[model samples]
Target: MRALHIITGLGVGGAEQQLRLLLRHLPADCDVVTLTNPGAVADGLAADGVRVVHLGMGGNRDLAALPRLVRVIRAGGYDLVHTHLYRACVYGRLAARVAGVRAVVATEHSLGDSQMEGRRLTAGVRALYLASERLGSATVAVSEAVAERLKRWGVPAPRIEVVPNGIELDRFRFDRERRTRTRRRLGLPEGAFVVGGVGRLARGKRFDVLVHALARLPEDHWLLLVGGGPEEHVLRRTAHEAGVAGRVLFTGERPCAPDGSPGPDLPSLTSAMDLLASPSAEEAFGLAAVEALASGLPVLYTSCPAIEDLPAAAATDARRVRGGPEAYARAIAEVRAAGPGPRTAPPAAHHYSITRSTARLMDVYAAALAGSSPSLAPLGASPS
Candidate 1:
């Protein structure tokens, strides 16, 4: 089987990481075509020998690239086309339909109702997304929260499936030595509480909330901010204004290994933290939180419905904070007072493993090609 995977961009984010994991575990005989220009995940896919066709998309609505996308899909003779993120789902599904591909699947990674900014732009994107969802052979949601939101937006239930995101336990297994070394290398004081967060520095992610929370915490604690984005400078200014600039360490964009190689620094970065703080106002699924949990680190997140859908044990380590600076600070203090329990045993490898996620995806692909209605189980159903 030949599969074509499309994504909005190759930026380092949850959806991009999910796509990378899925591609790596797809059946060896299944030829894969990746669509995205060079970015963080691109080099990794290329190194894995996945055939990639860059559409040179400059932004979200690159209609000019649609013809090129269609040409590539037709020329590749793809049996199925799977798209990740909203932009890719809209354009890729339409292109696949135009190219006459047998199966076109899309994964909805965010809640439609949660995106309230920019009314004019949101309306246009919604129209495009609704049309694409109607035309898609199958639609997958990463969480039940996401699925329900999609249904509310008019996607028929029969066409949608809820598939929780998975992770590689082996890769994220807890490492005490690495954790110790990472903290020491970063020059953190001994016995100092460390709270780390990893995500794009953007409005959606709400990194400023974390800075405010840190400012309210005792002077003995430190906040580690990883990843980079357009909001970096603004966030830095906010931290300075809050008088917590010295307490926050902004490690601008850590480089992962090129060409699919594992970055030597990732394990230490994740393992070193006492807890993972996810202040994002919205998320389709908290991949970083899962990674932290797999490493036996706890998470403190905002009370987004999507994050609430995680298993109770996973949620137990997490305390849902409200939006304001005071609420965030109070929640952080509460979680700190109640230190995380003994590192929980990692969840089953199948639950979040790339291999399992890809296998379930293949079932959807096969159903789409067989001209049968896709079997979409309820949110949290195990793959049959």
Candidate 2:
């Protein structure tokens, strides 16, 4: 039950790769810290053995990193201290309440509707995020549209707690020979129709509205573009002013796990793709349109609170397409004239599965250590 996490910069986005995939399935004994560029999800959370720490936070009013993050949360005897993004939830809930660590928790992971991470919400950032969210006891919210945008940013629907972001359903399932060896190792071609765009090529991930909807398609359509940032040369000058710069590929920042890294690992670029456009009009938990509906692909999106709060037949190959780039070029040419379908994963990717979001985050860490510190120790039943 000795958790401790705190984040702000580990790089590779999506709430720093969903906090390195929720500290690899979290069963307690976790550890992490960042607060500044620790980069590459802090080397994949120190190659998954966890225990990372950097804290050199010199940015958001460092305040000398709040007593050096309260001396690394009081020398790490931590019983619980979760946190992620938004300047590590405002200096990890005031350094876990000055390191006494009364089981804090925080995970709003990008609140939207005017933005939080992409940074455009002011009034002193909602009074410093509702004043460090009243020094945390719980805050989760990765979906129910970011728990109704954190109860309209006043934050207290009994301290908000949706907990949806998750994956690892056999690492995004689909693999017909890994879609013909990741489309002949990314050169793609043999019957290409791709169109897949994952995330973080920034500019609010509009990804230049998938490069002007891949210049209104039809040239054997191919636009990959997986993760990488400061709008990778402004989305390669918006794929050369939407002339579709050589059918735009750009696989720069890939790693949703498969690290011997040098690209190609987001389930092998969502198995060489066929369709996963996410013209991100804004999203808190679209998670590459649920890992391209768990690699079954076919996702066209314009925001996804994890598939609009899951219902319409649990992601019938996910489709929303609202506007821009001619409404994703007539919804990717009506899904390429309705050709492909059954790749698999649908019940909205087994309803967000990373082991049921690590058993609802160990029941929000045993109800935030029994509401703040009923003598610690009881976050027991998590892994299923």
| TM-scores vs. true structure, each candidate | 0.87, 0.33
> What tens-digit string does per-residue lDDT give for candidate 1 at 98-137?
7877778888776635572212336676777797777688
Tell me how many clashing residue pairs each candidate has: 3, 1
Off by over 4 Å in 1: 28-36, 58-64, 116-121, 257-266, 304-307, 310-314, 346-350, 372-384
Q: Give the lowest summed-lDDT range of ten residues in model 1.
A: 375-384
For model 2, the stretches where C-alpha displacement exceeds 4 angstroms are 1-4, 7-13, 18-49, 52-72, 77-91, 100-109, 114-128, 133-181, 185-193, 199-256, 260-277, 283-325, 330-384
